[model samples]
Target chain A: MPERSRAHEWTPITLLPLNGGPDPARLADSFLTPTSRFFVRNHGTIPIVDPDAFRLEISGMVRQPLRLSLDELTQRFPTVRRPALIQCAGFRRSELARVRAIPGELPWDEEPVSTAEWGGIRLADLLAAAMPDDAARHVAFEGCDDVEREGRRFGFGGSVTMEEAARHDVILAFEMNGEPLTAEHGWPLRAVVPNVIGARSVKWLTRIELRPTASENYFQRRAYKLVDRAGATTDAWEAAPAISTLPINTLICRPRGGERLCPGPIRLAGYAWSGEPGGVAAVEFSVRGGAGWRPARLSEINLPGCWREWTAEVDLASGRHDLLVRALLPDGSAQPADPAPLWNARGYMNNSWARAVLEVRAD
Target chain B: MPERSRAHEWTPITLLPLNGGPDPARLADSFLTPTSRFFVRNHGTIPIVDPDAFRLEISGMVRQPLRLSLDELTQRFPTVRRPALIQCAGFRRSELARVRAIPGELPWDEEPVSTAEWGGIRLADLLAAAMPDDAARHVAFEGCDDVEREGRRFGFGGSVTMEEAARHDVILAFEMNGEPLTAEHGWPLRAVVPNVIGARSVKWLTRIELRPTASENYFQRRAYKLVDRAGATTDAWEAAPAISTLPINTLICRPRGGERLCPGPIRLAGYAWSGEPGGVAAVEFSVRGGAGWRPARLSEINLPGCWREWTAEVDLASGRHDLLVRALLPDGSAQPADPAPLWNARGYMNNSWARAVLEVRAD
Candidate 1:
């Protein structure tokens, strides 16, 4: 269960699963997105399990199957905090949808992406207690929320390799921003896997299963792949690697859209991030309709798995303008200037240059 | 001193230093660029160094300075063969020049790049014999050729991190394609530093100096950097990173422009390469302007420091067409679509989508 950014500020992209987040303009003002401003990305209904009755079951390819109450899980392991970003696979799918229609998927704009401090018990300690078998290769998680998709009923599920699950930052977070988790954000328990698509961070989590293979959940097996054609054969879906790391991306948050301002020098702000070990090196912004790009100064040093804020100012004469932003990766690659090249069946990784249309009015 | 590619077939971009390579269409016909067709990128006048008098001096931050004659370099070290690609920093500058003027620099058009089998001794073996001190961080290289610029005459020089220079593949190559090197190709000896810009390879090897910092040579400190403005301040040049690893790039060699073919299905071929550890993951091509892109089939599994050949076909129905190719890197980034945003004072790393135009007419 994920919490809404703000009661009125939040706009639901999907009502059935209650998926939504705060506006982009609201995201530019702070180094860390406030807990209330964190995006909620749900694939199913928010589960309402009580903390007293909540029991996280550890089973599958482990030598011991243990059930721990919330108190036992919190007290047995030392509490630590990790600040990281959570971005939906379709964070900027709307831009892609403009190139080609994406049916049956939410047209996410610059929402469903935010950073926050997560306090929790390290998943490695819990996995060690369970005594995972040597044969175990993947750690699969199942949330309590009921997801009814493709005319089938099942709990939301996903997985990560054992190597990733054992990482120090991967945790079973019970608190966010120093407060107990809200119902919408996996109330009593949840799993937070950093530097990956948000779908793998199962919210309202209750089950942790270790297996010799990846989880067979539809989300992990079929939905998250970068398939090019619609209704691809099963082999195509299975052969395609599941989307793991997100691309280096940037978003223009200020002047979110359709804004009128007096002509003159105006400050623009945004955020850029990359899941690669070498995070975003630099970001450039253009107000000249892709004619030229200028570097934006970044504030705060970039931390591993965290996005950095950037700002730039440009003088605008009275007129309409299409502002664009793109990130430069350490590999000497930059985000594409057009979206048509990035369009795919699922609209995943639409890291094409982001654009915001602005109208500069004379005083 | 470097032999021209079949004389009539080679078109010298610059006559003084003798810079040129075979037409790219000749490159796509073979996986390995023929030794005679290998690109010659010289920054100065090739020197006529007699083999007996050619001494490669290894000094600077090393415990013991050692000078080895050509005979000693060969007799003391075991012979090895390594296959690698050598790409000029201005391989596609002509493409960028189309978007913005690039004065003075050669307008390279898919030339100045090639691959060949280099036979020589591992640079690591020489470094071991020289015993570089702990304080040594960079390995600088200088050639026997004479370069004149800034009212001063000096040898062309550049450097790489000691870690990169010590790679198993970096070699002091004396043979190309199992034959003695031509004077044009650094007859006595040349250093082949794999995966870096060709500038660092340093033709006509004369010196290897281990240093506490990067080489102060004009090419290393100022010329090969990615400066945005003309006559950049010394501080700007010092702060900017010298062009090192080449970007993931693709070029269409088939139908090498100005082709008029009968309307029908036509084959397209090219090469794609990246300097990243995780090589080029995929390459996509477009025949419909920039409307859509299709995956191209790559041949000969990619090897470290080498480029892979790719081919695709599209139906052309009695009209003009602009074929384009773009490479996808493992970091989830793609070659940019337009060159306008990549405009810089020196047209370095213009990895925009490569295009080749054709006029398909009816008989």
Candidate 2:
């Protein structure tokens, strides 16, 4: 075996449902987060599937249902490589849960995200072959992994609008970074939809359904939404859109909170990203507790659906200091400064400014 | 002249162009903000409109151009009364400006909004009468007021998509609070587009145009947009969407910051409003700088496009304290606690938690 899964390094939020945050230092400095260092997020149990027998079924409001094996899917369709950053919608839930009570949610910290080159066929080409019906407005993706919510067991599933399904970057990938996806990651086949929450990037792919409305799957219909009210009526849940378009965000990696630092010039680095078409225009840091802000340089090479690395320099004194970073999107939306305003019932999409308190000492 | 036009009590942001914020204390108590206490926001000099002679033109991408007098407009169409809370997109920009310099735009505080019953003809009905062409996707509103920007004079103008134009609350108002239109308040006619930024509701209406794209007016195309970059390219501006949909916000009227009072049980009251369809579902306040947040009781009577009064009581000790309030929208979005993340180049949509510091002094 080529070493072992990077499960040990990950801080476990839950073991059975399998969600973990990666060690920030190992994952931070690199542009493409290694598969081993990538954080794992799953809503259900990982299933064992036979690669030869695995068939991705495309059905529902299409002219005809399709069941294609891995060979047929890879050989028959036009393949493309897409680089995408997958983030749990609840990436910074811990920060928000600290400020407010987001009960029942696994309090995710600043990990649950990583970038990789995914090899797949464009979902559009596959949809075109399937021939969607005129009335089909949504396309649902179902995974083989069984997820239990409220005692009933079902596959972890989600749906996207037909327009979203047709985006050039939305794909069904079987490979990550030139290697076949590991079991912890989506194995055999998986959807690789960039720019949206990772939950929509369903794994252990089994079935795809085109429908007139959104998927009735519990994950799509009830969960993965940003409803502010508790005990929301079915109508309220119906009205809310599934969380999409990752907000402008920054991931501070080098200066880990509470890490010991010398009282001198220190390197500040992280990745800035957004789902907005304008992309991340700038990433700024405020070492003086938001009293002042200075711009950080973005990586010269940047791509959509991938995080751009950012670096800056700041002088630190022998004291405790909280460094703040905010990503500015060209579309005019920026990250909020405090987590208190971003507190939600589900603790999802807490794209507030990334704040890390550091300890500067004389060693 | 209606008690000196209530101008003396208003705080002037600009003198000649005439933008002013109403006294929040006076305007806060009333559900329907009185005409005298209504905040005035103008981009250009108020023009003297001759009601009888003035012709409202509906042209461009239509079956035929129309020029109807006020009498024809009122007598020919079905008149309706609409009550909407009109808020400048830059409301609470003053708080953001303190954190970051948002040059050029007016620094409006929390007082640039008020609600009054508007009497007018439904804009949808008017468009139906004009017989818009299928190619028309937008409806442009042109005001009589002359606004000069970059040495070019253009009537203050804006455009709304046909989807927004067809909203039930969009109207051409000739009366405010049952009184005849005032010069500063869109003398003869004004477009009252509820649930949108106040700028889209062009006052002193002179003409309307149907087109395939948005208005090319300075306010519509360039201004009133959220672009985080400095010196954004023309293409960036073109790609950026104009600011619309007043964010969920709260206005804390009682116990203004820096007011001295005895430390004891104090009553807190504010108005929460939203342009979103679900409106403000809940309003919450925290006395201890966001250590915790408690719910505030919403008023019994609430209306769409109008603020709902909320009240609460908190026991305080003798010292300095800060009060923060936030409005929660049913759509799963909440206000930010700090202004840093919401700070844009234009300082628009500062829906961060409303913060007010109070001093408790022994009497």
Per-prediction DockQ, in order?
A: 0.01, 0.01
Task: Assign candidate 2 its CAPRI class.
Answer: incorrect
Candidate 1 regions off by >4 Å? A1-363, B1-8
Q: Write the per-residue lDDT of candidate 2 for residues B260-347, one digit (tens) a residue.
A: 9798999988888888888888999998988788999876335567777788999998888889999998866788778888877788
User: Tens-digit lDDT track for model 2 on A179-218?
Assistant: 5777888887789988889989999888999999888899
| Per-model CA lDDT versus the true structure | 0.83, 0.82
**TM-score of every candidate:** 0.50, 0.50
Distance from true position, residue A100, model 2, in Å? 64
TM-score of 2: 0.50
